[model samples]
Target: MASFPTETHRFQSFDGVELAWTEMGPGNEGARPVVLIHGYFSTAEVNWIKYGHAAKLATKGLRVIMPDLRGHGQSAKPHDPASYPRDVLMQDGLALIAHLGLADYDLGGYSLGARTIVRMLANGAAPRRVVLAGMGLDGLTHTQGRGRYFHRVLTNLGSFERGTPEWLTEAFLKTTKGDPEALLRILDTFVDTPRDAIAAIAQPTLVVSGVEDFDNGQAHEVADLIPNGTYREIPGNHMSAVTRPELGDAIADFLAA
Candidate 1:
């Protein structure tokens, strides 16, 4: 697949933290906009652009806005624990949308990004549509479970035996050159979303997940919870699924429709 042109820009969030976001596809007036947020410890480049997801969406003639979450990628990584208040990521996403002047755009996120989208919706973000990828009901209601697991992984960096889940996560972290201190603080910022909040989401939502991915629970359950939600299963697991073209294809098709 041909690479799509991308532009990276920075903006200040609600707390004056500088965050970075990338843009793909046509910049012309009246182009439909879609904001794609990356997962935990992952950047917009790794989760979206690196695997051609952004490009695929761009090919559909949609403006793809990919943001590198705070403490990841080109965004400022503050080590201060106080800087990462509850729902800071959601606030950052909201700020990015405002900064870009996007009012009628679509929103999507994978894993942590997906959870963030749920928080945004519960907090009254009015996206025209939403795509929750690699997320499930447990992910929203039982966030502390995953947060604790990641805390262990981050707190105990090099002690995990080879072939263990922690080892694999640590390996991926190294690839991303993530800051454990900042990310550890990020883990504290996670907040659970009630089932009532999930059901209250009014926008049409697509809950798409990898067939083998259960890292965040069952995607179909998430779909079932939303008033206007549908589910789709694609190839691969949580890690491998993002590398598949099918992930991008599903998202582009949904947003275009």
Candidate 2:
């Protein structure tokens, strides 16, 4: 059974790319809203709804909005690398929030999604409260495994040796049904969002990570970077953390507080 009964839609990105999104729970007036961004190669259904996070929030009377970033899932998969300008990926997210007319709301995302949220903060989009999950300070400094290895995987494809990070990344991307060519170019444009700028984010923030997850380096340190950030540890690692109930529970409790 699906975690949340979602109403999905397709919208134009800031660059006119057709993007996809899904909504669960109430309208703006019915309850508070949260915009959740999914990680690279992941759709809204995989990241939020599949793991019960969105449904849990919806049950708490909060509206959850999940968008599949461009070049992933149902969104446009333009194979051209130039289609993704360095400054526009995060803008796609901000554009969605503005389209929804959400002046006051919470926001969150996981992995690449979290990185995008940090860039959004750096770009001056302030939500009432924010959640940065499965991401760390190292990630915002530059694109590490996300760009280099994912790019390698695409370039080599089946040539990658089994058990390597590139191999694993290719498998994961394939599992998620990601667009290979679009992702290859996404590597060219993945934002190395500035760390000093991220520190300027003053909104109350929650940085959640699995105890074993360090894909972007130290989780606690990333939380410390924000003036008002708090770190919460859940069980599991990067790939498995989102599937755990504790992750959703922690998020629900923190947002409610």
Give each model a TM-score: 0.98, 0.94
Tens digits of per-residue lDDT, candidate 1, 81-185, equal 878999999999888988888889999999999999999988878999999999978999999988889999998999999998899999999999999999999
Clash pairs detected, candidate 1? none
Cand. 1 Cα-lDDT? 0.92
Model 2 is weakest, by summed lDDT over 10 consecutive residues, at 144-153
Task: Enumerate residue pairs that collide in model 2.
Answer: none
Clashes of 1: 0
RMSD of each: 0.9, 1.9
